[model samples]
Target chain A: MRVCVLNGFDSEEMTVAQERKLEQELEVLNQKGDTVDYFKLRDRKIAYCLGCWDCWLKTPGECRIKDEQEDILKSFVKTDHLVFVSNVRLGFVTATLKKTMDRLIPNFLPYIRVYQNEFHHYPRYEKTPILHTRLIVDHTVERDEIDLIEDYFKRVALNFGSDLKSFKIIDGKGEEDYEFADM
Target chain B: MLICNGSPRGEMSNSATIAKWFLKDQDKVILLMKGPKHQEYLDILAAYDHIVFIYPLYVDAMPGIVKAFFERVAIADGLMAGKKVSFIIHSGFPESVHLEVLERYHRILSKKLGFVLADTIVIPGSEGFRLMPPKQNRKKQQDVMKLMDQFRIDQPFDDHLVRRLAGKRQSNKMRNFIFSLLEKTGITNLYWNSNLKRNNAYNKRFDKPYTEL
Candidate 1:
């Protein structure tokens, strides 16, 4: 299966050891009969959703504003499974992941119905499940914060008609145990 | 009132309208948008004595710029430590169960970063109601006015009123929606209830101290 792993970790200042550990984890997932492709969102300048509702009424399956959203949407459509890995900031998902999700809303056009009182959406893919994982780098988060973030991820996955397959909380000890070759 | 408009929609936003109600008669108010700011705008935020963050909840949490603003404030740690802080969160859901998610964020900031969190007001989206227009905007304004009246600048917080208010406004619609959404989305059966239990089992695993990287 083609498994696209989008790592939102700001890799520009990553330590050598941290980089190796992330690579190892991806390798492990890859070795397990899954093809992995990753994107670092910090390198890209993505805009937030304007809530124009134009995507639903006029544009149909595309956002009105032109930016990196179109390209990311194209990539998501072609992939079988999507993985979002990021470092937790202030007990929440990184801004990069949040922005990426906001940008992807246009792809759900026609398939999703959002009213004032309720939101209804058809499954994007019948057989293909979007499996997501939020790997938090231990240093910047607290235990309660992690709990809140985990719950947020689950809620989001449910909202998107997707599944949160797993949550890997990597503290210092588990850092060395991550094997990316198996990805 | 400090209104943090994180939605890209700007003025038409349901949350912004609510914030406006609270700003009545106030000589100074800080309206911070995500991408639009001149040096003067930044200076205004720096001059605030108390902050009231009003924003739409995205993905069960505060918007990115809301978090980013705290990071950019540089003095957030010092300013928030003993200062009055509150939230007016607007969401599309009928109930505001997701407000807990925001409270969780505040808890982290208060406990770890030394910010003092005051009362939080949550206004559920007005979508399916029969008689009312979207009252979130109006309600938010009234709510902030009420909060200001209830607030005592020099006194310690009275937990009784806060708890009573939070309890009275609690809606089961949000809880039901979260569960229903999970099942409707096909992710409900992916993991067993046991897995859910295990995920929340804090003490079963090793008791190693959590280290911040």
Candidate 2:
């Protein structure tokens, strides 16, 4: 499987122990012969989407701004499964990840299509990736926050004509408790 | 009070037009939320007792610029407790359901920041105001004017007005059929097509740059 992992954690937020656990998770995927493309978003320069609609109409499936985001968008469409790893801040994903999400609109055409009884932008690519969200937190997150995050990602997946395959939360207390389940 | 324009286009955004109309005769500073001046804006926001956020929905939620602001707010040493916050979210899509999750997230955000969620007013099909002439969006403009009247008196957004502004939530079969037809006939995408034509990229409107490898 061609799996792409987008890590939205900053240096201070990623503890040494947490890094080791993440390596273990990546190793598991690597051992299974899955080709993984990991992108640390904090290190990359991704500009905010200017709401220019150039990607849809002017350039057509291409963002005009020259940045590192083009590579991420390229990897995103080619990947079979997409994983978003971010530490929760302000009850949701980090700003780096949110910026990445905002820039993803270029991957879809501007034309509106009726899907699931609502309007959504048409996909620019034929294959939509299976999505997974993994959140890292220091303490227990509220159940409502978890559900709301999952639900929002579900909507994100829906917009891409895909489904959220799993929602995971890695609790970083005493012992590493992996509370991830396939949906 | 403070009005923050979270649109990436800064002052030229459709949200700016709405904010101006909403402000009318009110004496409030409309701060444009550019990326560099986060600390300055945070300090200004801390001083205000009430804040209004006006922005178009980007990718089904707050724009990256606005999300960045929220992250700053989470750690900033500001007394947000008892402060009132309101949101004026508009989007190109014609369905109110697209903004529901964002509305819920705003509630969570208010709780986390210890602020009062005054109200969330969503305006779907807001692209018409930007794409068409002023006369075409007169009704929407009038509705916003009425909403402004309520905002001045410190009263919560009237439920009936909120519902009317929200427009349609779910699409029935007949509505879907009509929209599909409009899409097929290029009527729904007239604005996009016109812009593409102006830019001489109409022929490549459906070009897919990121094909699956």
Candidate 3:
């Protein structure tokens, strides 16, 4: 399966240890023979989506603003599974990850078609196996907090018509205990 | 002003405890609990002059509700143009590493709406403030009040000072050891910790307390 991991951690000056741990996790996933593609949201300049409905009304399958987000969304369409890793901020996903999810709205837009007697708009993904992982640093969150966030993730996965295979809460205590290491 | 109480516990939140003091005597104070009414609150935010966001840090970042609120507002840019923005972020974690997350959102809001970003006031969570009684929380509350006075005086927020105070000194080996212990225990319930225990134990409502500027 082709797996794409979109990381929303800001990496401007990540410590050497942090970088290596992330790379090692990705390497392990890649070695599993799953063609894993990684995209860092912090590396790109992604603007918030303007609720102009332009993507739906005027431009088909495209956001109004011309940016790197469009290409990233397109890539998600081609991938078999998508893994979104975000450092939990406050008590939820980071703004970068949230913006990325907001920009992906175009991908799920219904393409109108005549099914039987009346014209019906069918969503792009009738059923797709999409595995999502939310790796929050252990030091940053307590165990009770994970349940609430996992519930939100489940809802998000359901909204996208994908099966949420697992929710991995990684306590960034060390490389050894990293959830991705076990994977 | 739009004041977002970003604690999951709603009214019984430490951030709200501090915010009430800062906003007392003000005519307009909109309290937004992190849930369904958020969109309704955003619509109302357009009419406000100053936007004060009071949130607790979750995983070194703003809570999901805050992010969702921003997404909703950012989509409709100019909803808060020419408005002053300030923040009172509370976090159990020591370092202000989480402040960068707020800074990023501030930049996004500033770029989109052309608003004046006011100084942000961040309070470190007390050792047991979340679970401590108001009387017990007096010292931390006083500290927050002092910060508010400085905020009203237009004192520039010194990021360097904040960073120095909140810097993490743990070695990678220590981090690794902790991670290994959690993994070995097969404890998927890693989110449950001493912080929550404290937060649940002492979270309460009290009269707003602030220093007059």
Fraction of the true interface contacts (Cα pairs closer than 8 Å across chains) found in each model: 0.25, 0.80, 0.04
Query: Which stretches of candidate 1 lie above 4 Å from their native place?
Result: A14-16, A24-33, A109-128, A172-174, A179-183, B27-31, B36-42, B74-79, B126-144, B152-213
- Candidate 3's C-alpha runs over 4 A off are A11-19, A31-33, A110-122, A125-129, A176-183, B1-213
Candidate 2 or 3, higher TM-score?
2
Full ranking by lDDT: 2, 1, 3
Tens-place lDDT digits, model 3, residues A58-81: 443457778878657666766777
Give lDDT tens digits, candidate 1, residues A41-146.
7877777666665554454455778886666666666667677777766556666777777666555522333332335444333333465665656665567877
lDDT top scorer: 2
lDDT of candidate 2 over B84-155, digit per residue (tens) = 888889988888998999989889888898998888889998774654677777777777767766765678
The sequence of per-residue lDDT tens digits that candidate 2 reaches over residues A1-183 is 788888887555454566567767776777777777888898898888888888887898899998999888899989888888888778877788889989988889888899988899899888889999887777646777787888889999989899988888777651563322221
lDDT string, candidate 3, B75-183, tens digits:
6757777777777776554434334455445554565557777766656533235566778766556655555555555565556544333445222455545644665
Q: How accurate is candidate 1 locally (lDDT)?
A: 0.57
Clashes of 1: 24
Report the C-alpha lDDT of model 1 over B1-213, residue by residue, as the tens digit. Answer: 345555555666666566555564653544445455623555665566566676776656766656656555533445445656666666655455546677667767666546467766656653212224646335334545667555536343445544433443344566546767876774643432333344553222221111110
RMSD of each: 11.6, 2.3, 19.1
Candidate 2's C-alpha runs over 4 A off are A14-16, A174-183, B29-33
DockQ of 3: 0.04
C-alpha local distance difference test of each model? 0.57, 0.81, 0.57
Per-prediction TM-score: 0.74, 0.93, 0.46
Q: Rank the candidates by DockQ, best first.
A: 2, 1, 3
